[model samples]
Target: MKLQDILTPDCTICAVPAASKKRILEFLSSLAAEKLVNHDTFQLLESLVKRERMGSTGIGNGIAIPHGRLINATKPIAVLITTEQAINFDAIDHRPVDIFIALFVPEEECQNHLCTLQSIATIFRDKQFCKQVRQCKSNHELFQLIQQAS
Candidate 1:
């Protein structure tokens, strides 16, 4: 699956003002909920939190991909956010995170979920892509950057 297939401009945010990891997750959870058939933010948030308990999704270099699987989800949904300021995220590199691309996939789509994660992780690994994303000034700009990058 492609990142563009799952993520829409409507689900991206630039310069999001969040102070902590929980707040960031809550915000992304809200975005994910908007696309869910059940519209249950709490359930999605719980799944994300549970995943974090197992291990942080922060792969380093100022990025984090907090993700989870929802049993009732009909398909995958993704949200991208750039925080106004970096926040500690327990990243492997111990650096604060400013970029977050969160995902919620249907529980049954294991292969698709893995591929999507791999795609996102690969994209974020590009220093130039990460730099361009950080330079975005608005959600519209961020959305355009993602489209252009793809």
Candidate 2:
């Protein structure tokens, strides 16, 4: 799915004030709930955190893509956050992640999930594009940036 389809204006946050992995996940989950995602935000956070335990989703360059699959979901959703301070993610590049793009996909949508991830990853690979997202300071601006990418 396109980032624009899943990323709502409310889902895009600028300057998350979290400093650790758990805090980051909690912050993101709260955004999902505030966005009216149809699930227990804390449970979703736990699943995503478990996934992270298996392996860090931090893709380097001050970015982290924490994601998970859920049985209750029928579609995918994205939550974007730019932290006020960088947090350690145990990334391959060994860098702190400041920009986070979390995804939640339905258990039945494996192929779609991979495609969505590929699309997000490609969009993120463009350092300039990622820089633009990082530069956004408001929810409206962040949604616009994501829309432009799609």
lDDT winner among the candidates?
Answer: 1
Off by over 4 Å in 2: 35-38
TM-scores for all candidates: the values are: 0.97, 0.93
Model 2 — TM-score against the truth?
Answer: 0.93
Could you tell me the TM-score of candidate 1? 0.97
How well is each residue in 1-150 modelled by candidate 2, as lDDT tens digits?
777778888788898787798899988887776654578878789878889989999998988889988877767888999988898989879999998999988888999888888888888999999789778888788888888884
Tens-digit lDDT string for candidate 1 (1-150): 877788898899999998899999999998888878785889989989999999999899999999999887788999999999999999999999999999999899999999999999888889999999999998999988887765
Q: Evaluated with TM-score, which candidate comes out highest?
A: 1
Off by over 4 Å in 1: none
Q: State the weakest 10-residue window (summed lDDT) of model 1.
A: 32-41
